[model samples]
Target: MTNIAPPLVLTVAGSDSGGGAGIQADLKTMLAHGVHGMSVIAAVTAQNSRGVQGYWELPPEAVRAQLDSVLSDIGVHAVKTGMLASTALVETVAEVLAGAGAPVVVDPVGVSKHGDALLEPSAVDAVRTALLPVATVATPNLWEVEQLTGVKVVDEAGMREAAEAVKALGPRWALIKGGHLPGEPADLLFDGTREYRFTAPRHDNRHTHGTGCTLASAIASNLALGADVPDAVARAKEYVTGAIAAGFPLGTGIGPVDHGWRQRAALDQSRS
Candidate 1:
């Protein structure tokens, strides 16, 4: 008998003690996509459904060591990054990723779901100059779009401009998420000349934490499984839409989207 391995995906991000977002969400999403998930923790947060209280960033040397250890040994097929909390960490991760021979999904995480600051104010420039340039796909929500490029997306029409501004920052594809806009959730994907729009019915759930981290990891997983940039985003959108719709309450505040929604749905269908 022979044993086979699943596609490998790596996440470089912070840890959410609440287990609803950050590395936890990333790994759960990778597992849901049937991929081997690996992580390089860049920071750790004292966080929960209520909000982020505080965060501590790891040293650049520590982050670099983890990256080297993983890439030199169990190489990844795709990589996703989130919540690099400082300028040094951002630069360190970006430098190593510039040489990593895998598709990279860069989620420019600026703030938490409760509006707590995650990335340092000083790190914003590093993210724009160093990190975004090396990304295969940069997934920025409407807030992140403004943070990174000063492009505010108020309507669907404004998302194209946001996409173009993000594309100018050097990512091969810029996925400007328009979920914050006053309509059905929509995201625009652009690669200089071509464009793709993805939309899903809006779920009326406030417990939709971890949406960004989960979506980016799903995209990385799909890419590791050999989907092209557009297809990867499309697949990720569907998975996250289901998760958001199935979100549940927790911790007396906003809870997380169900990373295992697909599995639960399948089990229920089989039983019925």
Candidate 2:
């Protein structure tokens, strides 16, 4: 007899040497949700808690070949994309996923945790036109929301408008993360007719390095496991909140949230 799972998630993103965000964070978030995760590296970044120093975007053929290899065998239940550095890479990935027929979570990553540019200006239109239209949900930070749609989000109120602007791009849903705003950390999800707000008390800790990647990956995992978009967003928000509260200090600069904080708790409970 064989026991097999029903769903799997694919992350098409970049490698973060720092392990705080990008591909590393996506995989960690998937595992934390009890889902199998696979990745296609689109770029390699020299990064740390402080910032990104350098990056190299992989060739489009290499990116497509990786995606094809994964899809031909292992197969995917859902897909999430982040840090596609160039217009060409974005087009290639869009073409591949367009036929993959899996629910996709597109995180239009514009800047890093330390405010470094991750996406090229030339890629913005490609991302909006090619990638987002095929997405089940488009997750963008406030900065990204502005860059992609010219929608400025200064508060929770502005998130709705930003989400609508992003939804106009063709995604079924848009999650505009409001953690960058002053006050509590809140996220807004809009799907044309309805809106949902996910709010949590802002943790004072300065170690939130991978929150965006983590949230989007978590949502993708849930979707792969058959949860609907709103439910997925709600659960991802809760998980990230816990991770933030349990974040650990790493390098001398900003640090990463604890992706396996739940595992640590379970271990402590067993010992007790």
Candidate 3:
């Protein structure tokens, strides 16, 4: 009998000790999308449902070594990056990824769910100059859009401007997430020439801790599975919407969207 291997997806991000966001969420989302997830932890955080207490970044050389190890041996079909805390780490990862030959999904993680800072302010410029240029898709929330490009998105009408601003920063495609807007949650995708919009009913759930990481990982997973940019973003948005709707409370703070909501839903349906 022949064995088939699943597509390999890599995540370069920080580790959340709470297991709700960052590396943990990335891997869980990848699994939910049926892809093999590999990680190169850039930083480690003493974090939980309440907030991030502190974070320690690994040495740049160690991060580079891990990237080389993975790229040289196992390789990758797609890559997603989140919370690369410092300037050195951002530049190092960007250098390696420039030659990785895989679709890159960048989640410009600036702050945690509880408003704790994730990326250093000094590193923001590095992210724009060194990292975004290599990204196949750059996913930024409204706040991140302003942080990166100074384009503030207050309504759905402003998403197009934000997406264009992000695209001008050098990403092949820019996805401006408008979940913070007043109405329904919507995201705009732009690649200079073409545009796409993805929307889902706004869930009133507050336990949406890992939404950003989950969405980016799902996009990477779909890309690894051979979905084009628009198709991947569309599928990822759908999956994350379901997860958010099924979100359950955890600890005393915001919880994570259910990464395995689809699986649980399937099992429930079968039993019924």
Write model 2 residue lDDT over 1-272, tens digit each, in one string.
Answer: 99987579999999999999999999999998999999999999999987999999999999999999999999999999999999999999999999998999999988898989889999999999999999999999888888999989877778878989999999999988998898878888999999999999888888999988999999999999889999999989999999999988998999999999999999999999
Displacement of the residue 126 alpha carbon in candidate 2, Å: 0.6
lDDT of candidate 1 over 48-79, digit per residue (tens): 99999999999999999999999999998999
- Model 2 alpha-carbon drift over 4 Å, by segment: none
Question: Ten consecutive residues with minimal summed lDDT in candidate 2?
Answer: 151-160
**Cand. 1 Cα-lDDT:** 0.96
Which residue pairs does candidate 2 place in steric collision?
none
TM-score for each candidate, following the candidate numbering: 0.99, 0.98, 0.99
Q: What C-alpha lDDT does candidate 3 achieve relative to the native structure?
A: 0.95
Local error of candidate 2 at residue 103 (angstroms): 0.4
Kindly give the stretch of ten consecutive residues in candidate 1 with the minimal lDDT sum. 177-186
Model 3 TM-score, all chains together: 0.99
The Cα RMSD of model 2 versus the native structure comes to 0.9
User: What is candidate 3's lDDT per residue for 19-38, written digit by digit as tens?
Assistant: 88999999999999999999
Clashing pairs in 3: none
